[model samples]
Target: MGSYRWNWPILLADPYYGWIVSGFGNTCLIAVLAWSIAFPLGSAIGIARTTELRPLRLVGTIYVEVFRNIPLLAQMFLWYFVVPELLPQDWGHWVKRDMPYPQFLTSVLCLGLYTASRVAEQVRSGLEAIPRGQHHAGLAMGLTPAQVYRYVRLPVAYRIIIPSLTSDFLGVFKNSSLALTIGVLELTSQARQIEEYTFAAFEAFATATLLYCAVTGIVILAMRQVERRTRIPGTIAIGAQ
Candidate 1:
């Protein structure tokens, strides 16, 4: 323990600090892009699962089952390596050669799709939790099924599931660290590099841990505010009326 010297100064220095900042930026960008893809795709699939159409429901169920069952690391590898090869020769070549930042793009798609499965389940659960009479009431008002979903079901379902979605959003950011394995130099990767060069494993990892906690804390706080504001009167039972 006496041999260990913590150097916070190095993290604040010129080139090393720059690397950390760049990694943080990449992490944020990937998380945001992945969420953008996951939320809409997941919502659509979730809605489809609840619909009367057999084909649509089957499609949604299959997508959720397939993606959720597969390990995310395996999905990342498949997207980065195998998927491109499975494409047409020209497209494969383009993905392998002409595409800029292919690793980043691949990570985004893999993370997005993988997380979408979980999000779909949450959305489905939220929708199902709503009273069945609401659906009938919406239909009784002369609204088309689509209109009922748009106006009534989705809005309330989304409000009910905000907490779960917030957790998923946080998970997406944390999971972005997996991109390091596929050559995207996000924060965890940078932290590894710091340890390699500086041989200060504790310092490197500790800083990374703190950064992760900070980001997650901010998300938790922000989402709590949203949850409070959007909370429905009787959706979540509190002891009293």
Candidate 2:
């Protein structure tokens, strides 16, 4: 360690800086895209798990169990390598070769599905946290079960789970680093590339560490604001905080 020289400026120098910037952008983009898929789908699955409908609950349970149990790295590999081959031959070929941004798209899908299972659980906890009286009151007012959820339950449940959802949102950003495995060229990938080119492993990764910390820190602060603003008085969400 005493003999090693640190070239911190290399990170801010030509090409390397650009790589960092674009990689950060890609990471953010992938997280946002995956969250788009995760939120609504996970909400539906969570609602299903709570519904009186047996088949819906069964299907939702299977989905959550299968996805949540599988390792995310394995899922990433399967989406990029195996899923394409499973399609019709021509379609497979297109997916593997002709498709634009295949790695990026695959990363988005893999992260989305993997994260949705966890989000479903958060939503379920949120739903269950609601007092039974609310559901009963809605029903007594002639609201269908679906209408009750659509109005009273869902709105309150979402607010109740804001902190949990914030955690999941942060997880998406961190998990996006795995996209580098399939060549999405996200932040981690760029840091590695910089290491390869300049042999400044410490500097490259140090910068990356700082950038990741900054981004996640910002996310935490922003989410806290959202949680505070959306928080319902006398709720478990606040009590837990």
Candidate 3:
């Protein structure tokens, strides 16, 4: 066999080192902000969709249908490039000049809104899955509508929806990579930088794939723990024979 050569200098001297770290940092930041925004908005929209108020339900339905039907890439592009132009000229200029990390912000908004649509559907379905008797008992207890939801409906709905929501969270995390197209410099972008600098396509791509797999695996494991702890009492255990 030829002499094994592990070039430490080549690894250390890779020109895109800064890009790799920066991209990973931005990916995490974007995913966190987007999830923070999406969860609350989605919960609210879901509650609205199930509310007695026709107007609120209609509005929620429209929002869900519109965003859910559209592509996330299109949503990001609209927020970043198209939204400013459609605004009044002075406001457009102000937005362009004043918005720090505009691509980051756009990624968050787009991902949050898009993911919220899916979440609303999940929450709605979860709420419906619970027995109607629970709501009747809450009302009979003289609980206000808000109280009924807070103390009864929402908790159970959320518990029931955990599995689906876990999947949604994973989807949001993966979609965060698309932010790179608008210059958010996430993991995939970092991998590209490494590839360009070292011309070691296999190594760079392998590193990126492993990193993503690790991140995803950790999230899935954490969510499984949550599922176990929060599971409805006396229900058959998930993954049980």
Candidate 4:
């Protein structure tokens, strides 16, 4: 411990700092893009799972089960490597050789599809937690099945599941670190690079740990505010009571 030089200033200065900052930005960009894809896709699948249509429900169930059961790292590799090969030969070569930012694009798609499975389960749970009578009432009021879901069901269900969704959102940010495995150079990867260059593993990882905490802390506070604003009165959250 005595010989370990604490050179945070060195780490914070010049090309090193720039690399870490760039990596942080990439992490954020990947997480946001992935969540953008996951949310709507998950919502649709969740709704499908709850619908009376068996075929639609089966499709939704299969999607959620297959994605959720598979490991994320495996999915990432599949998206980056196997998927392009599975495409037509011309397209495969294009993706492998000509596609810009292939790793980044593959990371976004992999993370989005992987996270969508968990989000789908949360959404399905939220929708199903609503009283059965609510559905009947919506129908009785002359609303079409679609309208009942669009205007009546989804809004309430979303409110009920905001807390769970918040967790999923944070999960996206944390999981973005896994992009390092495929050469995205996200924060974790950058930290490793810094350690290699500077021999300051402690400083590198400590800085990363603080940045992660800061980001997730902000998310937690923001989500809490959303929960406060959107929470329904007299209704318990899914796991409570």
TM-score for each of the candidates: 0.96, 0.95, 0.91, 0.96
Report model 4's TM-score to 2 decimal places.
0.96
lDDT of 1 at 232: 82
lDDT per residue as tens, model 3, 13-121 = 5456666667778877888888898899999999999989999999999999999877888888888899999999999998899988788888889899899998999
Model 4 residue 10 CA deviation in Å: 1.3
Off by over 4 Å in 2: 236-241
lDDT of 1 by residue, 119-153 (tens): 99999999998888999999999989999899999
For model 4, the superposed segments whose C-alpha errors exceed 4 Å read 236-241
- lDDT of every model, 2 decimals: 0.91, 0.91, 0.84, 0.92
Instruction: Single out the weakest 10-residue window by summed lDDT for candidate 2.
Output: 232-241
| Model 3 worst lDDT window (10 residues) | 1-10
lDDT of 1 at 84: 90
lDDT of 4 by residue, 126-188 (tens): 999999899999999999999999989999999989988989989999999999999999999
Find the candidate with the highest lDDT and give its number. Answer: 4
Off by over 4 Å in 3: 1-14, 237-241
